[model samples]
Target: MQRPDDVRWPVRVARAVLHAQATGTLIAQYGLVERAWPAALPAVPATRLGVQANCLTDVGVRGMDEAAVFLAEHLKLQGLPEAGEPVERLSAGGWAARHAAGEHSDADFCAVIDAQACFAGAWATARELVSAVLESGGPPRSPGALLYAAVVAGGEANPPVPAAELFALAGKAAAREADALLVDLRLAAYTLKRLSHPPGALGRLAGLVRGTGDAERRHALSPADAATVRALAMNLEALALLKKAAAAVRTLEDNLAENRAGHPESVGETLSIAAYFHYREQDLTRALELIAEAYRLVRRDGAPDRLRGCRKIAVAALHCGGRTAEAEQVQLRMARDPLGFDEEIR
Candidate 1:
């Protein structure tokens, strides 16, 4: 199949983001090696977590296409043999085979993992892949990558390892390969993210926050790193005390231009956070406006989940604002649009 031009950069990025997240979820649910290497991921203690392959059904086959594109793009960007490339596909069986061939360097691995970790959906599966990578014997090509994989792996394993413990382990293992301070800072960022979400690792996040600010303030992150930090912050908002989470959201918005130039996903996230906050505060009018903004962005980009979320919020906001006619129209349109009715994508 022919690939679309990148002229639609924002939509492409958003699609890529969605694809990566969905792929991660698939890995977490079904176990990455389950179909191919049934005993692999499951044999690991972390396999105790049930990762239903069925979850991908909702995201649909496009999710897999996006995943393939993501891996292909990463491989090309890293100068590794992309499995999707005809010659490379024959040689590597595809991108995964090329990756397994040890042709990738530390920087290559770092770039891949960094891109992979940007989505929440990818968190669990990425963690498993990283853990397995850590146990793989080699002179440790990429310490930063190793540290990242270790942190993610620890998050899903049966024992449910603490980010801190993983941080320490990563520090000890990768210290000689990279600067301990840098490693610590990166570790701190992921720790903060893990704490900010459903499982709520507040204590760890709190401990990491102070020192992380010190390090990050002094260092400039790559554009990709900036995006990852923002995504992590979004996840963090849920786990943080309301006040702190609110403040973080504000900071994320303040720094929007840094990450938003060509990335609608980041922008949509900002809008979603703003909308969610306003909704919770009962400022339904403002929430409605922001949700509308979010819907506009996602709809243009083919991101159904964002649109669905915005639609739900907008309906509530319209009701609060007593704009019954507009609310009804929105509902009617939603019911009529086949794309809008994809509850699975929602």
Candidate 2:
């Protein structure tokens, strides 16, 4: 089918391919994609579209022939290409066949459509991941890793492709996909905390509080999970509030004493929170100080996760604070996982 004008399927396709790896659990976790399809695509199913609606259900996940039929019909309606012709056929094999037979004379059109299918597949994968992570129950694996997997898959799926010259070839997609992407990020943060408790738990709590405005469901957790849920929520609020107060001191410089007093901490987390604030404000010096204090406190307390988190903040603070030499040295010994870079980490 011809892509929508506003969708930009080329980019979407790239992102989808990158995110497909994490889709299985994401789909099972989330249960369903927030808003699956647009109103215009009546032919597309919310729960099932024969085999074409791979994102909705596993109705035809294994039937490529059925998928081809749907594609052929979609192509016929769009009038962009057809099944037997190189431009019209719907399979990876068909694409090869057309290319080999010289039936697809327009290389540009062939490239665009193939890219769209690949992206659609990736998007399907992400949706699947979201659904999986949110599901009520599953294996005992940490939720954080699943979430990280989703982000990793997502970033990998949509690697930037320089296609400014081929603007017309970009197939547009529904805004729902972008919305879905953000939701996935939020979910990733929640899952990450699940992987590692207390601090990771704290981060997840913070996310829930900050993300309340954008939550898809009013009641995401069950009544039985109340204690855990409250812990997650409160932890996020505390961290976020502490971070904000610290930022006020650095940026406004007027709120330092006031924020610090309100965010009193006997443990070293207060310092870490301060560092978080300064880092956001770009006040690397102050951030480094707080991070150091936090690291010391965490080490004494014997909470490796919190300690590791503080160390990470310290490294980043040093790097941004113009202590490039120190930051480089610190980076060499750190765990250095890319999962930390996921948008949800914000």
Candidate 3:
């Protein structure tokens, strides 16, 4: 089948590879290669090599004849002198070695490393790469690299630099890259993590969330305003402001109702957040109602990880509502199908 020309296809493939790496499942990794490899064959050299390198690193060439064939084809396309060598004998590390020998662009290398760091929990390497990139930079070289740096710096363990400074740096990159919404969301998340019970911190997070919502409305983007609102509500809950948190959740629900068509995943996530808030408030009935809706949406249209999360919430609500047997059944289903592919719960 002929694949459509999509300039962003390489990035999507890279993300799938990263997700496979995070899941650490051979099924996920093989599924990505089978689906993405053919489509990516027609991409540009840099993109193709980047995607190939990421796949090879995450899923070794062992037992995968298709991977070997594609590697040879990609090398030939790139005019690499060693194209005829038996790829079956080459380890995944060999691909990295080739890239390090100047076959791939620095951007691709950094991007792959950033993916590993971001998704695969290679934080030490990510911190090092980000520091090197920033120290040698003129302007923000990569928005994603900077964002990863900010996330690493904001983590609980001792940061390489102050989280605030890294976040500010990331903000600059976001402005240049036109990714302000993502930066705002990260900043809001950081605030929630760092602040214990300060009203001022919560107020700042609310402002960030509000600003993100305004920007989304102006651009007619997918109404991720619900997510920001939900984050703000979570911070309110952290501060023991239950009523205010409930109000924020209501706003989240309203946003979902208003823009349900743009992104079903976001709607599902917003509903799940609301259910958790209701669960915390001891409104088990309401919590179950919201979570059931979320489960149905995610089961039909969301990723396995999302379905798993929604199921967890359902279990919590059921267990708290004195339905221990039903909760156990759900728990058993969850354990049996970690991917959340089972039929709908009764």
Candidate 4:
């Protein structure tokens, strides 16, 4: 439950590797793992070693071949013979070779494929993998695998299956797996896409959000520790449940203010969402204040998307407050470069 850096070296290294694996940006993930790789040497847990190897393999496929080969050789030197082979194999022959070898569990294979699709943007490969699995009489049943297949089936541009049917199948699988959270959250999101503010779905989603926030508090996890609260807030916003969304945002802001959460990106996003909420409520002054703080936090890391989001909220609030010229300037700056503005809006 401690922060990644607050832990002992081994745990810190593992946490960093896991965090890298979860990161949305491949470059950032690769950098984090590359830096943590040295610290993971000699005697880390076998599980962590395997995870690091897998991560390096993923990065290598995405164009960081040197790191992958280096990690494989380093693991071999550490006498982790079992750990190095998969990296070497994956690097040399890729996921197909691994699948042919029949060594990986179905769950592991599905996870790797899912990562390829979600993180590496290999949708075609994902579809291929899913088809192969199905043809082999093994339709993905694990929650992660099912979720991935569902997303791919539903989200693609062309014809394969109806989005609604796939989502319903996924929801059922999630329910059977006792993953109440996923079922509720996934179904709520899917339903939202189909219908605007269905009362029953919104009610369920609101409860899920409240329940998750409560669970986080009970476990002493800062609402900002995971993306759960932030995601819940976004879902609420999508449902037009502003009051509940604002409550979730306040939890994130309070955790950030108390120094309980260290992720500035997450806090920045929550703030931006809150700013939009205030903007919707016609509190232009509060909207500007919140978005200014959000912009400041996001600019430190050059998060262009978050910066763009903050800019939109700030520009709207400024324009609505009779500062059209300032809004135009902000819009122009964002158009030039989302992260070019050095000064946060006041």
Evaluated with TM-score, which candidate comes out highest? 3
For candidate 4, the clash count comes to 0
**What is candidate 2's lDDT per residue for 128-180, written digit by digit as tens?**
32233224232113222232223323332232321111111111211332233
Q: How does model 4 score by TM-score?
A: 0.52
lDDT assessment of candidate 4: 0.49
Model 4 weakest 10-residue run by lDDT: 55-64
lDDT of 4 by residue, 1-346 (tens): 1112111222233334544455532233123353344433313223433223332112011212223333332333332112221222132124334444565455665554434432233444445555555445445565555655555554343425454455556557653322445445654654454344456556766776676666576764454432544454353444455456556455544544543245433455567766887787778987899899877776653334556778899889998999999999888887765432466653
Give the Cα lDDT of each candidate.
0.43, 0.36, 0.49, 0.49
The clash numbers for all candidates, in the given order, read: 7, 49, 0, 0
lDDT (C-alpha) at residue 124 in model 1: 40
Tens-digit per-residue lDDT, 252-325, candidate 3: 55655644655453566667767877787788888888888887766553234556677788898898889999
What digit string (tens of lDDT, one per residue) describes model 1 on residues 147-172?
A: 55444443432424354665566577
Candidate 3 lDDT (Cα, 0 to 1): 0.49
Candidate 3 has what TM-score? 0.58
Per-model TM-score versus the true fold: 0.46, 0.27, 0.58, 0.52
Q: Return the lDDT, model 4, position 63.
A: 19
